[model samples]
Target: MAGNWNNLQVPAGVRDLLPAEAAALRELEQELVAFFQSWGYQEVLTPTFEFVETFQAGSPAGDEGSLYKFIDREGRVLALRPEMTAPIARLVATSLRREALPLRLCYSARVFRYEEPQAGRLREFHQAGVELIGAGGVAADGEIIALAVETLLKAGLKDFRLGIGQVAVTKGVLQDLDLPREAVARIKVALAGKDLVGLERLVDEYSLTGLKRRQLELLATLHGGKEALEEARANFIQTGAAAALAGLEEVWQALTAYGLEKWLFIDLGILRDFDYYTGIVFEGYVPGLGVPVCGGGRYDGLVGQFGYPCPATGFALGLERVLMARGEGQGGGQGGYLVAGRDLAAVLRRARELRRPGVMVIIDGESQNRQEAAARAAARGLALVWVD
Candidate 1:
């Protein structure tokens, strides 16, 4: 038999988070949980994986295909969770069936998606998010955006802007075009990426009129202050998409009432890839980073897909992305602690007592000296906390 050392490393686009990295991530998760809790949002944990059908039910991000799939003992098709919102919606419809209205829930979990991983993008990434269910209208939307802003602020991120958009606005434009559902979906994807060429090709394929074409082109640039919304209204007709735009206006008004307008920018072109989002959508972006640190929106119809009807809005902050935006990348004082001693009991007790909910390693070896132990720990990306 051939030796398998050649394939010993973890798969590409996947990595084992070292001690310090894991510790920093945990601290970030706890901070987010506490922030959500302070706003009366209770934390909840969903399973790491679920049935394939659960994820297939109307994903807005389009058919990216399943990231992780496996056949269980029962031979059922299962997949690693790509996102948390769908599971939370399922929870609300089933487990929390009789729960009170205006339910607020928060969760911090790793979501898996098979994609090219890069800085701030991972095959397995942790997301901290909150959902407010059973709440309708613009006030709920405003509150969700406000909470997102507050959460980032608590995370010590100051040089970031929240780009706000109303999916309704995009829907409204599509409604006036008389385009097929497939065309609209494709157009939305193109518009979401600000892919003007793709969108123009879509417009040509659909034979949209000059007016509609102009409206679609303008949508890409319809991002800024209040004036951007006004510009969109002037160019687009009052169709279904316009009705959605109206909802966006209402949300903007509510945000103003709460004095949170400063933290928000109106971007009518914004569209999250998730298929479930139905109304207002927003994302947080820093100056240099190419992607948003956080992104979310209203998904009022999601629960209905799971056998219930409840309005809801939520946001998910990518902890790793936030850390990167804040200039704290992978390697730092983040992970584990090295506790070494010949007397195992004493070392274990000391490590336990000093453990602060992050990663920790307790080394039990009689021959290794303190310096050797410290060096070993350092080499493994852990801090040296000798206890003997």
Candidate 2:
């Protein structure tokens, strides 16, 4: 029976893109891939799904529940890729291990995660990003951040801020407090969320007074330009935070040299994934967007989990989120030409001749006359070509 046919719709957290939306998405993807390639990053493609362990190797604690898992006939657990970085890590450790020390790879692919969908959140989404493998220190970190800034600009996003941070500094300062692991975890949540009230409560609950309470509070409030780093240095100079702060300082200097610091700021609390990111992490935020449009950082230990140890830094731009920020429909109108005529041979020849890279040509099949063809072309937002 055809009963309940209307109920057969896509599941929650996923949506289909119409023609204009699809075209816009492709255009952005092409632009980003070309830009990434210009920076010496070669593109790579990984499987849509990988062994469950691959994602687990880099995902944050408690994030495993978001994976969409299934067992194959071989009884091996497999899941859709929740993110590109982890899959790329697996790719590098095995296939590209013998290639070179610093491998710059990029990807444009779909990622799946099981989660409640909301604004800027989706179960299935597309991400375009790059990873610099086998590189360590401030230069690699600087390159990633600079590329991120340039990417947002290239995507036509004029109003955005890239907040850079060092997770190690946060870890170091928290460690010095000598708090229990669970307590440290709770405090990080508050700090990451910028929940000042919750942070204060946690401080009170732990009886953290004097410099200890102040230092913890600093992580939540320390955000701005160079002065933020200065403040952090003053407060954390004697602890392990010193080294991380020094590294971050170098990265900041490098970005300033790139003349891109105008788009950047220092946010020590920007711990993208406390467990996955080792040092120098950043997230891009637009004024009205409630979620980060893009984010990434150095993971010096991620590749190691795949049996090949190497340093890596990268960032991913949410294709949907970036498109939303640009506020553009980006229809299929650009370079679109509709060749319409009653002469089938002429129409076919003209279409073939007009078709080329970056140009779309469609031959009229249903249009009986020039008027009809023109209407059809206008409807699709294409330039009309009438052949008598």
Candidate 3:
């Protein structure tokens, strides 16, 4: 009778990172950490699972049903982190209070989100992000944008653009309409998708004036280049949404002073899906990718939700997407010098001597010739280093 057994397979939306691919990812992450560290951004690691209440501080638990959750032995609900920002905010409020102003923290971790997996997207994904807490000025905003651009450049990404927008603009436009909270939420969802038809339908249902309808339509078109901002400015003046226009101008001027004007474009319609984000928001995109590889913006009120009430801004980059943008292929295999020979003792000794942290793997056999041994080593993804 056949032996009873179970198939060994990872869950859907998750896969093993093969040897060479794992190495490539490690290299990329190390490079990013080093780059961020050089800029005085100290790295921090938060727990993989946090108490459910921690994430639900600002939003209802029912709203985030996609999160993986369970009740601990203590009877407290817990969840695998779906995102890092909330946990980091809690940390700042509780542990890092005594720390100095303008605290810079960096992190690299896996975030879980229950979503349909696709190319460059996985349910379990790695994210590297930094947060600047207590800094609440355009200069700080500009600095964050500049750092993001520099980080992507260091990661071997070219032909990328930074789409910048202020949430205040979208919020302001909706506020001017005096819509109810429920209606505002629906409008936000439509705007986030860049769904012009949906937005127009909602506007019509609400009986918005011709000017209000035009303004809503214009938000979708407020993307591309400098001219877009100018057009938005003119449109806002006529519609009396001057405050939103001014916020955009502040961000634009700050970016220009930081010498990042060329890298950014105004996207008034850029609405963050998360309600936590307030003020300026930005996302980094490269050619050939439909989704943003990196995203963050001012969440000046996020910490406030955690009882800290500190203003802050941050961004997170998807490691897989960055690797794809750099054209780095998957992990190949074991990466070390391979030693093969009939004299097992000598080969073992040589391998031990060469093995420090990242050098040497021993394979012993006399049946295979030098060429055969080299072929075997290559197949195993090891570099052949012969022993005399």
TM-score of each: 0.84, 0.95, 0.88
Off by over 4 Å in 3: 1-9, 57-62, 237-247, 332-336, 352-367, 378-383
> What lDDT does candidate 3 reach at residue 309?
91
Cα TM-score of candidate 2? 0.95
lDDT of 1 by residue, 127-228 (tens): 999999999887888889989988999988988889888777677777787877787878887987778888878878888877788878887877777788
lDDT of 1 at 257: 80
Residues 153-259, candidate 3, lDDT per residue (tens digit)?
A: 89888789998887777677777778888887777778776788898899889998876777788777778666887787777675455765676677688778777
| Top-lDDT structure, candidate number | 2
Q: Model 2's lDDT to the true fold?
A: 0.88
lDDT of 3 at 186: 79
lDDT for 127 (candidate 2): 97
151: Cα error in model 3, Å: 1.4
**If both were scored by TM-score, which would come out higher, candidate 2 or candidate 3?**
2
Task: Give me the runs in candidate 2 sitting further than 4 Å from their true place.
Answer: 329-332
In model 2, pairs of residues that clash are none
